[model samples]
Target: MKTLTVFTPTYNRAYCLEKCYHSLVRQDNEDFIWLIIDDGSTDNTKELVNQWKQEKKIDIKYHWQENQGMHGAHNTAYKLIETELNVCIDSDDYMADGAVERILSYWKKYGNENVSGIAALDATIEHQIIGSKFPEKLNRATLFDLYNKYGVTGDKKLVYRTELTKLYPYPIFQDEKYVGLAYKYYMLDKQYEMLLMNEVLCHVEYLPDGSSLNMYNQYLKNPKGFSFYRKELMKLPFGGKVFKYKQAIHYVSSNLLMKNPKLFIETPKKALTVLAFPLGFLLYVFIIKKTRTEVN
Candidate 1:
């Protein structure tokens, strides 16, 4: 069995997915399996992955299923992953050179049950670190604190233990996709702090089609999913008052979008939710207007 599984959840991104494949082929360490979750793509994704599988240069496992959105694809990936460790390298992203070797080596030296897994830097293709490197001399911190406390900004790559990743599956709401993937990470944060590595493990590209680029649209389309995530975040034990209030604001907005009358009743932080109502309603209006403008 491989030590790590490098899984990619892709929709109809076969055009640019080849960059990820070639990067994997160039890996200095081959102890990772590439699992592709084809989330109901209409394009030639199946054909492209099939061709790569036949080449036999690296281990590839491909699974196809109806469109259930990104979280649904993630649910399937967790179920099928057999490795001890796993990292999601998005279809539009690729590993930095020797990233696998670096991850495996660093983990071997400092990893243990005390940590959930490693949290490493992500860089642009031009090799600029997405944000400040992990706090100097800080070895471990929950994902939430890394931002709220340490002031670390921008996206980072996460490598998690398979057992932990399987624990909190994102809820699948009918007709809605796009639950914030951070929901599970924050849940894990309640129990474990991650080993912080400053090395850039992955290079990311934010295409127009990528979810990050169109979040207001996602916010409108996935109200139920976002509502569920916000409610859960409000319940997290670690987040501070302001953080919880921010989640409450989003929670209120999502419920308002759903037209769920019991917004206050459904909230985990009722007081915060009440306090956040004005801002949340304003945010709700802003989202509606913003998305509507984009559409028109």
Candidate 2:
């Protein structure tokens, strides 16, 4: 088996997906398999990937399913991955040169059952770290603490053990499609600390259609998923009070978007939820107004 499964969850992103394919093909060491989870694209994605498969430059596996959003595609990716380790490279993103080789070397030196996998850095297309690199002195940290406490910022490249990753698949909500992907990472954080590697693994591009750029619309259309994600964040004990309160604020906003009557009852911290009401209500009103003018 390949050392890693580099998975991409794609939805109508065939235009930019080639960069990902090219980068994978250029890997200095082919210690990885490319897994593409096609989330119901009404485009030429299937044909394009078929052409790549015929080339046979490297191992490629493709699965197509109805659109259930990024988190749902992730659910499918985790289920299908058979390698001991896996990492998600967004459909619009690609790995840095030698990234696969570095990851394989790192795992060989540091991987063990006690830890889940490596948390590597992500760089922008211009080749700059997305945020501060992991602390030079630290060798490992839980994914929760990396953001919640240790001041690591921005999204990082996360490689996980397939066994543990399969255990915390992101929950799929009925008729909803925007759960924060971090839900699974935090759940795993409770069980294992991630090895911190300071090498850049993936180079990211924030395409116009990507979720990060379309969050306002996501907030308006997928309030239940957002609300569920916030509730889960509030329940995690490692998060700071301020962090939980921030989640509560968003939770309240999402609840209000859904016109949920039991917002306070559903919130993990009632007092904070109460305090966040005015702001949350304001955000809810803002999202409504914003959605009205946007065609998407």
Candidate 3:
């Protein structure tokens, strides 16, 4: 049995999925399985994966489903993964040479029930580390505190215990497909802190069509999901008042985007929601204006 399942949630990314496959096949170690969760791609992704399945260079498991956005695919991935540990590598991204070996070695040295799993590093194809190294002299830190409290920057690789990842599953929103993936991570933060690994585990390439570049469109189109994520953030036990209010502001904006009539009444924290009104309304207006600008 493999120690880790490296899953990629993809939708219509056939053109670049091969890079990920090539990278995985080249891994120095074979202690991990690659799980590809195809999120309703209309392209030739299935055929490509099927072809790779025959190669037998590494373990490849393909599961396809309707276009349920990234969170839905993540949900499916978690449901299917049976490994002790797992990490997500995007369809457009690939792991570094020997990255699997590094992760395995690090976990073998330090991983235990007290910690979730390794929180590793990410680098670009050009070999640039995405963020600062984990806080010096830190043995463990929750995902939220690493960014919010210690001021760690950039996206990092997250390898989690399969059991822990299964506990805080992401919720599916109707008619919307975009939810902040961190909703589950934050929930996990409430329970466990992650072990920081300084080695780069994955290489990232941000495509033009990626979610990072089109967040405004995501906000406009997926207000319900965003609102749901924000509401959940407001309820986290460890985050401070300012952070909760920030979430409240986004929650307000998402509700406004959906034009929900009972926004005030539905808020979990009315005072924060009330205080965030001006900024939230402004954000709603900005999103509308931004969309109009793009259209014109």
Candidate 4:
């Protein structure tokens, strides 16, 4: 069995898939498998992967399924991966020169059943750390501590034990009203503390087309989705205590003020003041405009 399974779920990202494929082929450690879940791409994704598969440079597995969104691809990846540890590398992202080697070495030296997973640094544009580092010795953080300390931003930074990861399939929702795959890690945090590795392992390219870059548009298009996100987040095992009502109020108010300004105008004055504080409203508008400009 492979020690690690590195998977990518792609939909219409054929242009950048080769970078991921080539990087995997050059991994210092060969005890890893690549699982590509093609989320119903009409592009040349299948042909691209198939050529690589035929070359047999690395252990590659490919699956084709109707596009169910990111969470759906995650659900499929979890079920299919048989390795002890799993990492999801976005199609647009690639691993650093010796990332898999370093990850394997760390796991062999420090990993055990008690350690739920390992965390690594992710480099965004210009190969810089996307954010601040989590403090060392966080091998036993509660769900709240993970978010408060690590900020719970990028999915690529985490490597999960396959057993624990498979336990939480994406939660079913009442409406297609939410953003992509925000709550799964929160669910995972309830079950385990992630081991922190201060080294940079993944290079994450923050394309203007990336989902996280379009928060304002997503909010405007799907307030119901944000509401559903809040509801589902509250359902996590440790949700209520970790993510209190204040967080929810802050998130909703900020999003509305940025995406749906008219809705902010309609909010009751007292609640609005509490949710959208003095600088919060200004920052929200500024960020939205800046991000939209970047996207354009």
Best prediction by TM-score: 1
Local accuracy of candidate 3 as per-residue lDDT tens digits, 234-255: 9889789999989999999999
All models: lDDT? 0.94, 0.91, 0.92, 0.73
lDDT: which candidate is best?
1
lDDT of 4 at 48: 89
Can you tell me which runs of candidate 4 are displaced by over 4 Å? 136-143, 149-156, 172-180, 221-225, 235-243, 250-296
Ranked by TM-score from best down, the candidates are 1, 3, 2, 4
Q: Candidate 3, overall lDDT?
A: 0.92
lDDT of 2 at 126: 98
lDDT of 1 by residue, 168-213 (tens): 9999999998898999999999999999998999999999999999
Which wins on lDDT, candidate 2 or candidate 4? 2
lDDT of 3 at 287: 96
- Ranked by lDDT, the better of candidates 1 and 4 is 1
Candidate 2 lDDT over 5-72, as tens digits, reads 99999999999999999999999999789999999999999999999999999999999999999999
Q: Model 4: per-residue lDDT, tens digit, 81-103?
A: 99999998999999888889999
Better of 1 and 2 by TM-score: 1
